[model samples]
Target: MGWITTTWHRLGSPRWFYGMMAPWQTGFGIAALVLLAVGSVWGLVWAPADYQQGDSFRIIYIHVPTVIVAQSAYMTLGAAGLVLLVWRMKMADVAMVAIVPFGMAMTALGLFTGAVWGRPTWGTWWEWTDARLVSTLILLFLYFGLHALRQAIPAAESAARACAVLAIAGLVNIPIIKYSVEWWTTLHQGSTFSMRRINMPAVMYLPLLVNVIGMYCLFGYVMIARMRTEILRRERDTSWVVELVRRPDVR
Candidate 1:
């Protein structure tokens, strides 16, 4: 318990986290690039076509991974928000701010790809009444709302506090988004990984898993990179930042 508290406090330090994440950022970048490239090739070229949807279903490789990581990123944002309100950790808010942009991009990608998938499959580009689709759009709007809120508030602390409340409150939508397919009738499909077994064939499923992992790696790389920059911006007046800039070895 004591060590846990020490480590958690240490993680709150910008300098410590900045240095600690250096190697991890490189690893994440390399892993994401390699995994995504390989997964794309495997999913697009080699994976068997869906019996029903044909090659058009190949977009699942992109669509599923994006939505999966997008929701996961929002969950992270909500957790950071909790930390911000509870412990008043500034680093938690730094992470909350950093997560919004990429999370927004991922959510947008998911919605766009879903619409593309829907065009051929359902013969429709958009479905307003579907629970899953509506919830996902709301998720994207929440990201946009957070950004707008931050910009609207002139005071940093006030913005953080307001965003924290929004992020936490928005969490109810996550479960709604996740289970919407089950709870209501919709064009969206149910869970891919069931409690008993996978709903997909092994050959098709493997590449999707790889891309999902790659997307998560990409998310990590982006978040850490942004957080590092945010830290530098926040600590610009400090001596360490001045010394860091003077050092030629800065990466």
Candidate 2:
């Protein structure tokens, strides 16, 4: 508990957080590139074709990861929002800004991938009766709303507060998105890999796991890079930021 508290304190300090994350971000970047390259190649070429869906099912490599990350990212945003709202931490606000774009990207990727997958699997590009699909669509709108609200507010503090409020309020949608299928009679299927047990064959599960891990690493790398940018942007007037920009090596 003590260590966790200290870590959070350090994260609340922009300079401390920036310095600490710099090296980790560099490592994450390299790792993300490697993982993404391997995962994409393996998923695209090496993974065995599905017995039932064949080549069309390959879309799961992209779609599943994007959907997972999209939901997780929103949860992250909400958590960050809570920190900012309760503690009035500027770093949390910066993190919120840094993460929203990636979340939006994930949402877009999921939607596009789902549509592509649907055309081949379901013989239709879309289905309104699919609760998961509809909820995902709603999540995209929620992201847009939060983003727009942040932009409309002029003051950084005010904008952060507004965004935090919006994000916290929006969190109610995530559970609905996750449980939508089970909650209602829907076209979408239930969870594939449950925490309680893995039900699928190893052949299908292996590539899916790889894709998921790679996507997570990629998203973390993106978030770190963007957070650095946000830190610099917010702290433009600070001496550390000015010195960083002026350094020849920084360029």
Candidate 3:
């Protein structure tokens, strides 16, 4: 317990955390690239086509993964918010800001791909009444709102606190998004992966699992890189940062 507490405190140090993440970033980045590439190719070519939707269903490989990542990212933001509010961890705030853009992008991609998939399946590009769709758009807006709030506030501490409050409040939407299909009438289907049973076939789901894991790796890689940048920016005036930057291999 003592060691764990000490380690946690050590992680709060920007220099130590940055140095430690270097190897993690490299490993996860390479793994993400390889897994994503392989999974994408396998999903597009080798995976069996859907009986009804056929080739169009292949989009799920990207669509589902992106939506999953988006939701998970928002949850992470909420967790960071909690850390910031309670522990006042600067790294937590950095993490929250660093992940916002990626979360927004994932949400956008999910919506866009859903629309593309919907065009043929539902015969419409947009469905305003769909609970899943509407709720997800709201989630995107939440990301936007958070980002806007951060930029609008000049003081770092104030901005972090404000964003933390918003993030914690916005967590209400996650459960709503998850249970939307069941809670109300909607065109959207229930979860593909469930604890009770697998809803998809092995061939199709295997590649999807691969892509999901790869996407997670990609998210971790990107978040670490972004957090490092945020740390550098925030710590620019600190002696450790100055010394690190002066090193020949700093970049």
Candidate 4:
């Protein structure tokens, strides 16, 4: 608890957090690249074709991870919003900004992959009645709403507050998005392999697991990179940021 609180306090200071995260982000950046390469190769070449869907199911390599990250991103945003609302943590606000682009990318990936998968499996590129599809679409709109809100608000503090409010409100859609297939009739299937239960063959699951791990690293890399940029932008007038930017090593 002490460590957690201390870390939180440190993160509240952009200079301290930026200094600490520099090396960590660099490490994750390298890991992200390596994992993405390995996972892509394994999923694309080594994984077996799905018995039901054949080669078309290979899309899962990209689709499943994107879908997973998209949901997780919203949850992260909501958590950040709560922190901002309660503690008024500027770090959390920065976190929310950092997560936006990555979340948007994931949402876009999910939509693209869904369309690609749908073409071969459902004979249509799109479907309106499918709850999962509909919810995912809503998720995309939520990302757009947050992004737009950030831009429209002029003041930094105002932008953070507005984005936090939108994030907290939009959080309601996250659970709905997750449970849409279960709550309503939909073309999308329920999770086949959840953490609570594992029912699939190792051969079929390993590639998915790898892809998921890779995507998680990739998400972290992108989030931290963007966060660093945000820190620099917001702190440009500060002496610490100025000194950091002027460092010989940095240049």
Candidate 5:
């Protein structure tokens, strides 16, 4: 417990956190690249085609991972918001900002891929009445609104507080999105991956598991890189930042 507390306190220091994360960022980035490359080839080429959807079902490799990442990113934002509001941690604010763009991109990609998958499967590019589709679209809009709120505010602290409030409020939608398919009639299929039972075959799911893990690693790499940059920008006037900048060995 003492060691854990000490490490936690050290992590709260921007300089320490930045230095510690550099090596992890590099390791995760390389792993993400390799895993994503292998997973993509395996999923798109080597995996057996769907008995019904055929080759088009391969898009699931991209779609499922992005959607999962999108949801996870928003959850991270909500947790960061809580930390910023309760503990007044500047690192939490930086994390929230760092997560936004990636979340938005993933949400957008999920929507696009869903639409492409829908066109052939559902006979329509979109369905307004589909609860899952509507909820997911709402999730995308929430990301847009959060980004706009962050940018529109001029004062740094005020902006962070406002975004934090919004992030916390928007978390109500996450459960709605998750349960939408089950709660209402919709074209969207039920989850393929579940803790209770495995709905998909091993051949199809293995590459998907790889892609999901790779995407998560990619998110971590990007978040750490962005957080380090944000910390430097926010703490440029601090002594540690100044000394770190002057050091020849520090990259």
Candidate 6:
């Protein structure tokens, strides 16, 4: 209990948080590369072709993981925003800025792959009226808004507050994205796998599970690395950062 409490307090410190995440970066980074490779190879080469979509269905390995993680990454932003608002932790704000670009990239990738999958499946590359599609488009825009907000405000705390408010408010969109297919009559299918249950066959879902885990590890690795870099920039004048910067090993 004491150790947990101490660690929680130390987490508020940039130096402590930076050092604490070193092992997580190494572990998750390596897992990301290995699992992504294994999952991609297995899904593409071994998984049975769909009766309906055939080889085209293989795109789900990439599409599912990217979209899942993109939604999750935005939730991370919302959580960070809450922390910043309640605790005024600058590190939380650092986390938000760090995740925005990555989240945006993932969202874009998901949309692109969805389009590719749609072309043959739906006979259309883009559909502005689809609930799932439109909600996701709005998500991407929310990320863009946060990025632009950061650039618009030069004052650190002021930017943090504005971004925090937006991030918190944006939480509303995530659920809409998750439930869009069900809430409206949409072409998109409900997800086939969840942590609580797998609605897919083992042979097909196993590789997807691997890719999901890999994508999450990749997110962790990227987010932590970005936060570390941001911490150095934010705490440039701190003694530990100065000392670390001076070390011959770092150079």
lDDT of each: 0.95, 0.86, 0.93, 0.87, 0.93, 0.93
Q: What C-alpha lDDT does candidate 2 achieve relative to the native structure?
A: 0.86
Model 3 bad stretches (over 4 Å): none
Best-to-worst order by lDDT is: 1, 6, 3, 5, 4, 2
RMSD of 4: 1.2
- lDDT tens per residue, model 2, 113-231: 88888887888888888888889999999889888998898988899999999999999999998889789986665787778988677877787887788788877888888988888
Each prediction's TM-score versus the true structure: 0.98, 0.95, 0.97, 0.96, 0.96, 0.97
Best by lDDT: 1
* Per-residue lDDT value at 205 in model 4: 74
The residue pairs that clash in candidate 4, if any, are none
Q: How far is candidate 2 from the true structure (C-alpha RMSD, Å)?
A: 1.3
Query: What does the lDDT read for residue 206 in candidate 2?
Result: 80
Q: Write the per-residue lDDT of candidate 3 for residues 63-179, one digit (tens) a residue.
A: 998999999999999999999999998889989988999999999999999999999888898889999999999999999999999999999899999999999999999999999
- Error (Å) of candidate 5 at residue 10 is 1.9
The window of 10 residues in a row where model 1 has the poorest summed lDDT is 188-197
Listed per candidate, the RMSD to the true structure in angstroms reads 1.1, 1.3, 1.1, 1.2, 1.3, 1.1
True-vs-predicted CA distance for residue 36, candidate 3, Å: 0.8
lDDT of 5 at 72: 96
lDDT of 2 at 244: 81
